[model samples]
Target: MKILVCIKQVPQKDAPLKLNAAGTWIHEDVSYEVNEPDAYALEEALRQKEKHGGEVVVLTAGPARAQQVLREALAKGADRAIHLEDEKFVQLDSANTARAIHAAIAQESFDLIVTGLQSDDFGAAQTGVLLAEILGIPHATIIIGIEKTDTGLRLKRELEAGHYQHIETTMPALLTIQSGINKLRYATLIGIKQAKMKPVRKVTWADVESKISPNLQQIVRLYVPEKQKRTEMMEGPAPEVARKVVDYLRTAARVI
Candidate 1:
């Protein structure tokens, strides 16, 4: 079983974010780490490889610093990694990103391709489906669990309204794993040392021929949502205050 896990480098959730001068995306001045959910996908891939006896190859697309996240994945037990580095790809939408991945994966046959349901920064859960379409493979999203069967792969998917669906797919498929699917493990000292020697393959968008051209839907002007605060006073005794609170919930807060 050859498993390919797609990962991404993203700003830490708690990291202070500031929009750029053009108000397009966050300013890059602080440190970054692997996207949280992608880590779970990596962990699941490694677990699958350990059980099934195969290689887990990690892949990411970003600038040079993206290599840091790739190394971190290597330390976590990925056999190797591919860094898809290109400046033109920095602002590319999910369609273009999936195109690049499809171009790269076309060269290598893989039994399974795994990725996080979405990136933390973008939260566009479209890549896996698009890549599957490009690769012509079955795909599943928001997968919380996976079990390998003699005939194919069994997966549990999280749906709206807290529902779950179990589905099965044959080999050469794609899956986008949801976060919290499994516990993430830290890199051990031995693993860290081993990662330094692991092979990290670097590729660029120009290196592969794009089978499809990118049709950009829209140029995003990223901006942080403005923060505002307000306070209101309730008059009268406890009962009146409670009534006011209920009114607030019913009208302003909309919780009721």
Candidate 2:
């Protein structure tokens, strides 16, 4: 089995964020790390490779800094890495992003493609499905568990309100893994050293521009939400106060 895991680098959880001067995006001068959900996806891929005896390839699309996530995956037991290098990739919507990813790896024969349910930054939760559509493969989202079978693969999907449904699918399928399905493994010292020697193939955006379609969405502007506080005091008879509170709830709070 040749499993491909799609990962991403995102702003660290604790990193302070600030809108850029144009208020169109966050400032880029902050620390970044492997997206938390993507880490879980990589962990699951590694586990699958360990059980099935196959290669685990990690793929990431971003600027140069994004290579760090790929290197981290390599240190965690991925056979190799692919870096889709493009500064403009950050601006592309989920559809275009999926298109670029498909262009980069479409020629490769992969038994399975795995990705996080959604990116931490965008939270669009659409890339994996779009990629599956582009590849003409069946896909399942919010997958919480996977079991390999003689004929194909069995997947446990998470549904709303703590419900789960099991589905069976054949190879060449795509899945968006939900986080917390498994514990993540840290890179050992030996693995870290070996990762430096692992192959990291770089593909520039220009190489795949023709395969990319125009973006369907774009960020118009981004800004910090304005914060405000208000206070009201009601003093009257008990019944009158109760009636006033209900009126306030209906008119101001809109909760009644």
Candidate 3:
């Protein structure tokens, strides 16, 4: 089994964020880390490889800083890494991002492809589904568990309200993994040293530019909401106060 895990680098959860001067996006001069959910996806892929005896390849599309996540994946036991280097990746919507990923790996023969349920930054939750559609493969989202069967693969999907459904699908399938599917392994000292020697193939934007389409969506503005406080006091008879409160809610607050 050759499993490919798609990971992404995102701003650290607690990092302070500021919108750029143009108000088009967040400033990029902040700390970044492997997207939390994508880490779980990588962990699941490593477990699958350990059980099935095959190679686990980590893939990511981003600027140079994105290599950090790939290196981390290599240190955790991925056989190799593929870096889709492009500065524009930071602005591309999920559709164009999926198209670039497909262009990079479409020639490779992978039995299974895995990605996080959604990216931490965009939270669009559409890349894996779009990738599956671009590749013409079966896919399942919010997968909580996976099992290898003699005929194909069995997957446990998470549904709303704590429900789960199990389904079987053939190989060459794409899956968007939910976090906490398994325990994440730390990189041992030896693994860290070995990762430096692992192969990291780079695919430049020029290689896939033709395949990528213009972003279907773009951020128009990003800004923190202003905080405001207001107080309303009503002093009257019981019936009058109740009516006034209802009117305030219905007209001023517009919450009724």
Candidate 4:
């Protein structure tokens, strides 16, 4: 089995975010790390490879700084990497992004592809779906477990309300992995040294420009919501206060 794992570099969880001057997106001057869910997906891929005896390749599309995630993945256990490098990719919608990836790896063959359930920054949860759609492959989302079978694969999907659903599918499939699927392994000194020797193929914007269509969606503006505090004390008879509270909730708060 040859598995392709798609990872993303995103702003660190605790990093402060600021809007750029145009408010079109967040400033890119913050610390970045491998997207959490994607990390889990990568871990799952590595684990699968360890058990099945196959190659694990990692892919990421982002700005130059994004190469850090690729290096980290290579150090962790990815056999090699493919980097879609360009500053403009930051503006690409899920559709165009998937198109770019398809264009880059059009000739490569893989039995399975893995991606995160969602991106931490955008939280769109659409790129993996779009990729699978563009590739015309069977895909499963929010998968937390994967069991290899003689014929194909068995997957455990996380559902709302703490529920789970099991599924079976064949190879040449894609999957969107949920976080906490496996324990992430850190790169050791030996792994770090070996990663430096790993191959990372770079695919630039110019390489796949023709394959990408004009973005159908773009972020018009991004801003932090303003915070405010308001408090009111009701002083009256119990029945009147109760009526007022109920009315406030029904009319203003809209909770009821």
lDDT at position 88, candidate 2: 86
lDDT of 4 by residue, 1-256 (tens): 8999999999999999999999998888899999999999999999999999999999999888999999999999899999999998878998998999999889899999999999998888999889889999999999999999998999999999999999999988999999999999999989899999999999999999999998999888887999888899998999999999999999999999
- Residue 251 alpha-carbon offset, candidate 1, angstroms: 11
Task: Please give the distance, in angstroms, between residue 160's alpha carbon in candidate 3 and its true position after superposition.
Answer: 0.9
The TM-score, computed over Cα atoms with residue i paired to residue i, of candidate 4 is 0.92
Q: Estimate candidate 2's alpha-carbon lDDT, on a 0 to 1 scale.
A: 0.93
For residues 126-241, what per-residue lDDT tens digits would candidate 3 score against the true structure?
Answer: 99999999999999999999999998999999999989999999999999999999999999999999999999999999999999887789888887999898777899899999
Enumerate clash totals for all models, in the order shown.
0, 0, 0, 0
Q: How high is each candidate's TM-score? A: 0.89, 0.93, 0.92, 0.92
Candidate 2 local lDDT, 8-48, one digit each (tens)? 99999899999998988889999999988889999999999
List per-candidate RMSD values in Å: 2.9, 1.9, 2.2, 2.3
Off by over 4 Å in 2: 233-256
